[model samples]
Target: MINRIHIHLSLLVCTILEIIPMPISFGTYRPDWLLMGLVFWNMFHPQNMNIGIAFLYGLVLDVLLGYTLGMHALAFSLVMYVASIHHLRFKNYSIWQQSGIVGLYTAFHNMVLFWSQHWLNDAFFHLNYFWPIATTMFLWPWCFWLLNRVRRERLRH
Candidate 1:
């Protein structure tokens, strides 16, 4: 059986990491922890980590970070949908290939957030805002590898 408790604990840790404030200069470049967690879990545990769960994660993040309600919910849900639908195919991909796909997913998530923020608040546009796309893409392989090792180890015992 999949370990529900471990899954939740991992998500809690990701959420904590997401909210930890960084310096303004670096904060804008922070990878989306919650997005990565959702992507990883959904990719590996599609049955358990579905869109509803992703929506909840995003909702919690919205409430915590004081973003527009449902903004993250929508973006995360979209990511989950894409990941779950392609989980089988993605599972067979090489690590680098998986990372490239994940990079695209992360960029899509960010684009949705950017557009929504613009629509809601008329937020200023900056090319620098796209930094997380590269950072997330760059970090995906390590995050997936580390999480996969931990997941395998936990499930083995």
Candidate 2:
């Protein structure tokens, strides 16, 4: 169906956006747009984007961005799996609570990615990995609102 295609397209765009590098000054604090999208998809249509898909997406990201082979995939799959388990809870949480959880999730995701990068080559470790978590957390409210609106409108249509 066209609707399904649109959903996939949206997620793909979000993932591509994630691969593009932002300012280095922003450091590890960059927002996890793909992670956010995965969570959004799982929250609304868990059947569409499950753990397997999350892992695949992670692998693709690693290849596209030249990260360690299974690093992003592993973290992404795990985070998505955990998020999927509590999709309903995410929907029910207050904005503050959701933001807090997202912050923690992004932080952990960044740590795993950093570890994987170093595993691939000793040159990948840096102190900046923590920044992405902070930045992603700051962006969580905006991301959740925007994506939630999209999900709601599509459902309405």
Candidate 3:
């Protein structure tokens, strides 16, 4: 269906943004665009966005980023699960409330990535690592509004 294609296209754009290189100095602050997109679609369209879809998207990201194959897949699966659990309640909340929940979701995603990296590579955890969660939270309102607009104006035909 056209709506399904629109959803996939939005995900594809998120993947593209996720891998786009940034200067190393500012890279730590880059929002998790893909995770944000995943949360949005999973929360708003639970039937269309499931754990399997999250895994597939995360697998693509792993291949693109050349990380361990299942790392992101696992994280994304968990994020989707959490979103699916609260989707109904989240739908009725104001944008600010939704963004607050999204902040927690983003933090959980980051926590998974951080622990996985430390487990796989013995990477050191630092305060700077939390920056992305904050940035993603700050950006959630805008991202939600734009994506919602697209779904309404472009996918509602």
Query: Which number leads on TM-score?
Result: 3
The RMSD of every model to the true structure, in order and in angstroms, is: 1.3, 2.1, 1.1
What is the lDDT ranking, best to worst?
3, 1, 2
Off by over 4 Å in 1: none
What is the model-wide C-alpha lDDT for candidate 2?
0.80
Q: In model 1, where is the ten-residue run with the lowest total lDDT?
A: 1-10
TM-score-best of 1 and 2:
1
Name the lDDT of candidate 1. 0.87
Each candidate's TM vs. the true structure? 0.94, 0.86, 0.95
Task: Give model 2's TM-score versus the native structure.
Answer: 0.86
Which lDDT tens digits does candidate 2 get at residues 7-67?
6777788887786767876545557888878887787787877999889889888898877
Error of 1 at 1 (Å): 6.1
How far in Å is the alpha carbon of 74 misplaced in model 3?
A: 0.4
Can you list the residue pairs that collide in candidate 1? none
Candidate 2 Cα misplacement greater than 4 A, ranges: 1-3, 123-125
